[model samples]
Target: MKYIWFLPLSLLMLASCDDHLLGTTESAPCVRQPPLTYENFGLPMIEKNCAGCHSSLHAGIDRSNAPVGVDFDTWDGILLWADRIHVRTYEDLTMPPTGGLTEVELDDFDEWMRCEVFPNAERF
Candidate 1:
């Protein structure tokens, strides 16, 4: 059938593992010796860097124009928006509009997201 070519083309596309289309680096496997978690590494980072604008407690003008339901005050919230967080904070490099995270923090964040948050299921 004429459509037979479509199958191979589709397989080729899938084989490319283009994660950028999803705005996530989920294709990258966790290489960190010890994975980072929300409690120890992520919470402090979010509190210091994101909560001022993205916390649930912050409302109205205090939210600093951050969209509602994007709060990073809780682990669940972080999980829900994990991809967006990765794209904005890490890939796009457009987050924390004023004060940016240090290089060390960015590295840790990249690790946490790739390993703990949006881990590549293929690795398992």
Candidate 2:
């Protein structure tokens, strides 16, 4: 039937893993993560995938593509935006502006943010 095509399209649309679809920001956090620490995982992963657009300065290269006032250059800066990072990365799953990272990297990032637990139960 002509209407049958719409079924697949609707399914595809609903499959988008965005958090907004769930109607709440307080979604389930990730479990089954590796050791959680800035020195161990956060720094290296963020630097490789997020630093280009989020750092203080990167070889004086123009970074108009990224938003201003949100620097991920240091642990403190990353901590400041950790909530947003979790939202954008895990909930919305829409960040890093450009989709430069491979699927493995994205998976790793998502796992780290969600499953990776911090001491004292900190957010980042």
Candidate 3:
């Protein structure tokens, strides 16, 4: 009878001790995501932020129709002025000039510029 009780107590103690032996802790490592690409970053940001004003046939910056005069429609035009756009909209806090995206969205934009856009531009 007493032996049976000792078995359960020993098992519990062993289980608890295993955690200490393995050096288990309550904390976990944090992970962050990488940048976005043209297919993901450009289209979504343009659609949500720029399209309202700079859409096709609007204010001489038609984006939906074709690449024309700093067009945000194509990759070439976007890469052409990524820096200006980033500086003004993100860095300088100018674009969407009114209500704008949140901090995470801005960070995403910056990451995209740093990783995806600049690297490809340098290749060319």
Candidate 4:
């Protein structure tokens, strides 16, 4: 009968293993310390997460139907599509059809958008 306690303990451990179970939502505000820039943070992230389907080099079916002129290979493209990117990524959760980004990546994206993109866009 003492072994019955193991079931609830195991369930608790399993539940705690996933952040979603802890009631954390993707809408959580990002706090940037040193800050995230396009060169250091944004570019690399886009290369990894977005470029596969959103690069200009990918044409016809290779582009994965990412839409014409929706490339993110350049900072200029990113700046031009910033609002659409936000809506598609955060609000709609529809881009990056691969859904490969981790929690840390998402947080970095949030920080880059909030702290860098909107503030210094025109200057860039």
RMSD (CA, Å), each prediction: 4.7, 8.8, 18.5, 11.4
| Candidate 3 minimal-lDDT segment of 10 residues | 20-29
Best by lDDT: 1
TM-scores, in order shown?
0.74, 0.55, 0.58, 0.68
At residue 37, candidate 2 shows an lDDT of: 61
Q: Per-residue alpha-carbon lDDT of model 2 for 12-77, expressed as tens digits?
A: 888965532242235345554555466788789888767878888853445556677678888677
Least accurate 10 contiguous residues by lDDT in model 1:
18-27
lDDT of 4 at 51: 89
Worst 10 residues of 2 by lDDT: 19-28
Where does candidate 3 stray beyond 4 Å? 1-35, 55-68
Candidate ranking (lDDT, best to worst): 1, 4, 2, 3
Per-residue lDDT of model 3, residues 2-107, tens digit only: 5788888888888876221121132221223543677777678877787666544465433443334655556765677666667766668877767468988877
Candidates ranked, most accurate by TM-score first: 1, 4, 3, 2
Whole-model lDDT, model 3: 0.61
Least lDDT summed over 10 consecutive residues: which range in candidate 4? 18-27
In order, the Cα lDDT scores of the candidates are 0.78, 0.63, 0.61, 0.75
Candidate 4 has an lDDT of 0.75
